[model samples]
Target chain A: MSKAIITRNLTKRFGDFIATNAITFDVEQGEIFGFLGANGAGKTTAMRMLCGLLKPSSGEATVAGFNIFTQTEQVKRRIGYMSQKFSLYEDLTVKENIRFYGGIYGLSHQQIKSKTEELLGKLQLQQEAGQLVSSLPLGWKQKLSFSIAVLHNPSIVFLDEPTGGVDPITRRQFWDLIYEAADRGVTIFVTTHYMDEAEYCNRISIMVDGKIKALDTPAKLKEQYQAASMNDVFLQLARAKPGENNSSS
Target chain B: MQPIVIENVHKRFGDVKALHDISFSVEQGELFGLIGPDGAGKSTLFRILATLLLADQGSAFVNGLHVVKDYKAIRRQVGYMPGRFSLYQDLTIEENLNFFATIFKTSVEENYDLIKDIYEQIAPFKGRPAGKLSGGMKQKLALCCALVHKPAVLFLDEPTTGVDPVSRKEFWEMLQRLRQKGIPILVSTPYMDEAMLCDRVALIQKGEIMQINTPGNIVKSYGKKIWAMRADNMFRLIRDLRAFEGTDSCFAFGEYLHVTLHVPVEKVQAYLTPLQHGNLVIKPAQPGIEDAFMQLMQEQNETV
Candidate 1:
């Protein structure tokens, strides 16, 4: 399989402190990679660098077959990003929000029109296409944001805690959409607080204090760590006092 | 005597029925959980029970005193932690804790034993601004502040929603310890897995109680024999399983699809025989609290 993303010694430093300390990993195309870590564990720093939003202090990487350093704009065009906090524009109608995102992704008007129809049908929001985003339920808005992110058919999509505070049924539906996107050959990079969500990924990487402490399939990680679940595995790696287990990488 | 009792509680905010005919009782020394997703009325109900809001049509009691009638007494007897961090972010950790202690007319030293384990963890950063602390540390400080007054009962609303997994685990452990001390804790969370940690949980939706029982009993009551099914194309498998006549219900669980079959395993396999090109794998699966909750929610939706 082709690699969608690759990084070698990815390091992001702030003054004397390193936020992301020489982490290295590769993500294969069409893979759903779960990035797990406690808060302040450098996952955000690493993700920003990967997305070409933040310049790496020291690293070598490629995203969507483009060098992150030399071709940062190319890398940006090939990926979609959705954060948990940014619900679609509350004042805009569903269709209007879709149109805005499509325009930002540089899709043609003709392409955007067809994509808007397809998205409404796919999300079962035909009746809501003209409704203000705030009028829809939390679940609908969340699903819409995800669809809008992948509207331009980007090579990869980054979801930062997409299912936070959502109901179980909506969460289940969200995972189905994730599977659908992955089936369409789009790589998914997601960070979540829910351990169960971690188990859904093809492979997961657990970061602890600026380092990847464990990276493997959930099953293998559980077996290797002799833990019952990802929560236990996470606790085993991160339960230590802050900065106690920082090894010089 | 019951520590908390909510009887026929009905609350509405303008055009929205925030809570509907909600009623439940929490025993003294019991760790009770109000489990539900967002917009489930957990916060409204919590506010009423915490004496912060009054139910429109029903009565709520804290330590056997009326919420509206004895609001002052209830406020004194309960420690309330709102969903968001309610601490003074601009103040130092020590200052914030001391402020809350002052509100209850008690010093931190008076209740040091109650919040000592939690406060001591953040004590090293006592002089640091509350906003400067990390998420986990902020949560710990918030818990410390809540417990500083050492009330008879505690109300924590979605305390672990945005917290990290490791910190969430530690926070639950702290709740367990607090339970052992017989404080009669009332907590709410959106996480289904955390429902299992409570002694008894009330599953709420649309401001109504769906089910109230022990997590173990809830799973045991799931009458269907679940199967963990997976294939090469999970996206297609979910649609196909849902369309099958013999399928009772199917939902994605992790990498596999959890299907409750109306027929025998062999017949279900036979039905999937046509989709063998996808290399479908099927096996018996254990039903978790989440499964039970989903089943109940589906039933509720269908009835509506």
Candidate 2:
């Protein structure tokens, strides 16, 4: 499979502190790649660099065949980004938010109309199209935000803690949408605190203190760490003291 | 009287009924969990019990003090950590803890033993402002402030909602330790897995209690055979399984889909074999709190 994302020795530094240090990995097209880390573990910094939002202090990387340093705008156009905190405009109606995001992605008037119709139909939001985005349930809003993110058919979609506080049923429904996107060959680069979600990824990388401590499929990681679940694997990796090389590469 | 008793509590905001006939009680030194999703009336019930908000009907008591009649007394005897971190952001960690201690007519030194373990973790950053702390650190500081007065009961609202797994585990350990100190804790969370850590959990939804029992008992009462099904193409497998006639309910759980069936497992295997699902695996799976919660919610929806 062709590569959707690649990073070699990706590093970011602020003054004397190194936020992301010498991380290397590759995400295959259509792969569900999970980025796991604690709050201060530099996952955000590394993701920002890959998304072309922040310039790397050093190293090489490419997202959707576009170089991070030179083709930043091209990189942005080929990717979709969403986070739990910010996604849709609360003041706008559901259809209006879709149109606004469609316009932002440079979709034509005809394309925007068709996309809006398709989204409303797929999400079963036909009745809610006129409702204010803020008026919808949290689960509905999350699903709508995800649909809007992928409206432009970007090759890769980046989700930052997208399923943070929703109910169990809604959380599974959100993953169903994710599975649909991945089936369509959209590389999913996502981050989550929930370990169960970790098991859903095709492969995952756990970062510790600004380094890639472990990277593998969920099954292999469990076997390698002698753990029953991904939660145990995460705890064992994250709890290792800094500068300790407990992971067997 | 129980340390915390909520009897037929109801709250409404205009047209929306925020909580409906919510009733439960926490025994002394027990760690009782109110397990549900956001907007499930967990926070609303917490506010009512903590005397922060009045219920439209029914009653609540904290340490035998009526929530409405003895609001002031309840406030003095219960520690409430709201869903959002409600602390003096401009104040340093030490200042916030000290301020809360002073308000409760106690000193940090007086209750140092109560919050010692939690405080020492954030003490190194005592000089830093509360707003400057990380999510985990901020949570620890807030917990420390809550226990500084050493109230008779503790109320924590979604303390580990957005926290990572590692920090969430550590936070639960702290709660377990606090329970040993004989303070009844009434906590709320959106995570189903965390429900198992509590002594007992009330599976709540849409401002109503679905069931309340020990976590083990709740799982035991699922009363249905669940099977774990997986294949090379998970998306296709789920779609096919959901479309199958014998499938009752299918939801993804980690690597496999936890499916409840109306027919035998052999029938499911025979049906999927022809659909070209490679490496197909189907085995009997144990039901968890989440599975039981989903079943209860589905039943409630059908009845409504």
Candidate 3:
């Protein structure tokens, strides 16, 4: 299988601080890859670089078979992105939001019209097509945002903490959509704070202070760390940081 | 003695009922958790118990003081950390703590023992503005300010939400220490996994109590045959499982689809024998808090 993402000594620096230091990893095509890290562990910086939103200070990387630095526009066009903060027009209706996004991706007028209808049908939101996006429930909005992200049929999709405050049932359904997309050969790269969600990925990379501390499948990581769960494995790695305070836990 | 007691609390805003006839109690020194997702009325209930809002009906008492009648006294005895960060962003870390301490007619030195462990972590950056701190540091500071007064009961509303996994783990450890000091803690979280850390948890939804018990007991009461299942095409697998006659409910859990069935495991195997899928695996699985919560939610929906 071809690699969906590749990074060789990918590094990003801000002033004197090295936010992402010499990180290297590859995500297989159609695989769900979990990127785990603490708040300041440079997960976002690395993701920004991969998404072509931020330039890497050094090192080499490719996303969706395109070099992030040299072919930034090509990389952007080939990937879908979603974030914890919902980025839809609250004032717009559900159908209007879908059309707006579809247009942004440069779909033809005919293509946008059909895609909008298809999305509404898939999410079972045909009844609410004329309703404001803000009036919908949180779960519905989340599902809609995800569907919109992949509306252009990108090869890879990047989700950053996509299920932050959703209910258990909604989260369960959202994962189903993710599984559906992955089955259709869409590679998934996601960052999340929930340890349980981390187990859903085919492989996980745990980053600490701009470095990839542990990268492996959940089962293998558990065995290597002698941990009962992903949560324990994370705690073990986080505690190993040099001169780290707040170690009582 | 009970540090907190809430009886038949009800609240509504316009046509929407924020909370409904909620009642529970917290023992002295016990770390009690209110577990639910957003829009579950967890915050509404927290505000009422913290003496920040009044309920339409029912009564709440902290240290035997009524929430409405003795609101002033209760305020002095309960330390409330709202769901959102409410600390003075313009002030330095030390200044923020001192300001809170002064408001409670106390000094940082008076409660130094209570907050020393948490405060010291961010003490190095004590001179920095609160708004400039990292997410984890801001959380520690917020927790420190909450404890600066050394109140008898601590009310932390979703203290770990949006916090990194590492810091969340550490925050729970700090809560354990606070409980050891005989300070009762009333914490709330949307994360179901954190419920297991509490001595007792009240699984709440839309202002009503779904179940109140130890996390272990809740899981024990699930009493269903669940299988952790996966196949080459998970999407098709879920559809097929739902169509199977024996399936009671099917929901995705991480990489596996958790299916609770009415029939035996052997029957499920027989059903999958001729399925047009590859790499199918099914095994008997233990139910967790999330599964139990989902089951309860499903039952609640069916009844409604």
Candidate 4:
């Protein structure tokens, strides 16, 4: 499989502080990669750099085979990004939000109209298409936001804590949607605080302080760490003292 | 009287019913958790108990003081930490704690013993502005400020919502210490796993309390045989299990799909074996707090 993301010594520095310290990894095409880390562990900094929202201070990286430095726009175009804080407009109707994102992605009017209809049908939101996004339940709103994120069919999608504060069943339903997208060959690079969700990833990278401390399939990481669950594995890796096992692959 | 008593309290915002006849009580020195997802009225109930908002109907008591009639007395006796970080952004950590202490007609020195353990963790950053601290540090400072006055009871709303697992564990440990210190704590969280750490948890959803019991009792009383099933294609497995006639409910839980059956496990295995699922594994699984919560929510949804 072709590589969806590649980085060699990716580093981002904020003045004297090194927020992301020369991290290196690759995500394969259609792979569901979980980026795990504690708060202020440079997960966001690394994600921002890969998403082309922030410039790296040093090293090399490419997303969707495009250089993050010189081909930033190309990288951004080939990736769909959704964050819990900001995704859809509450005031806009479901269909309107779809049109807005579709237009922003430079889709033609004909394409946007067809995609909106198709999305509404698949999500069974044909009835809700005319209603304001705010009127829908939290689960429906999140699913709608995700559908709109991928309406333009980008090769890769980045989800930042997409299931935060959602109910259990709905959280699983959201994962089902993610699985469907991944089945269609859309690479998923996601970050989450929920460890159970981390288990759904094909592979995971746990960041501590500014480096990738552990990166592997969750089963292998569990075996290596002698953990029964992903939560235990996360606590062990995140609580490890700095300079303890600097690298694990 | 219980340290905290909520009797059929009801709260609504315009057309939306935020809390519907919510009633629960916390014994002295108990660490009680209100477990639910966002928009489940946990914060509304907390605000009513904190005397920050009035209930539309029914009543609540904190330390035997009426929430509505004795709002002033309740305010002085209860330490409330709202879900959002509400400390003075421009003030240093020490300043915030001192400010809270002063408002309660007490000084940090007067109740220093009450907050010593938690405060020491953040004391090194006492000079830092409240807004400058990291998420975990801010949480610690907030706990210290909440404890500085040494109120009769404590109300923490979603104290560990967005915090990482390590920090969340530490925060819960702090709560456990506080419980041992003989203060009743009414904390709320969206995470179901945290419910097990509490003395008892009230499973809430959509403006109503579904059940209130010890987390262990809640799981034991799930009243269904749950099975853990997994295959090479988990997504398809969930769909197939949900489509099965004998399946009552199926949900993705970590590495396996936790399923409740109407028939037998042998039947489920027999049904799925023909589907060409690679490396399928099926075994009886214990129901957890989340599983119980989901079951209750489903039953509630069906009834409504």
lDDT by residue (A1-249, candidate 3, tens digit) is: 999999999999888778899999999999999999887788888999999999999999999889999999999999999998898889999999999999999999999988988888989999999999978877899999999999999999999999987889998789889988998999999988888788888899998888999999987999999998888898888653423422111
Q: Per-residue lDDT of A1-249 in model 4, one digit per residue for the tens?
A: 899999999999877878899999999999999999987788888999999999999999999999998899999999999888767999999999999999999999999989998999989999988999988888888898889888889999999899989888889889999999998999999999899999999999999889999999989999999999999999998883422221111
True contacts kept of each: 0.70, 0.68, 0.63, 0.57
Query: Candidate 4 on B168-253: residue-level lDDT in tens?
Result: 99899889988999999999998989999999999999999999999999999999988998998888898899899999988888
CA shift of B125, model 2, Å: 2.2
Residue B67 CA error for candidate 2 (Å)? 1.4
Better of 2 and 3 by DockQ: 2
By summed lDDT, which 10 consecutive residues of candidate 3 chain B come out lowest? B129-138
True-vs-predicted CA distance for residue A115, candidate 3, Å: 1.7
User: Can you give the lDDT of residue B158 in candidate 4?
Assistant: 91
- What would the per-residue lDDT of candidate 3 be over residues B11-32, giving only the tens digit for each residue? 9987678899999999988999
lDDT of each: 0.88, 0.91, 0.89, 0.89
DockQ of 2: 0.50
The per-residue C-alpha lDDT of model 3 at residue B226 equals: 86
Model 3 chain A poorest 10 in a row by lDDT: A240-249
Provide a comma-separated list of chain B TM-scores, one per candidate: 0.96, 0.98, 0.96, 0.97
Q: Which digits, one per residue and each the tens of the lDDT, describe model 1 over residues A57-86? A: 998999999888888899999999998887
Candidate 1, pairs of clashing residues = none
DockQ of the candidate models in sequence: 0.52, 0.50, 0.46, 0.49
| Stronger candidate by DockQ (1 vs 2) | 1
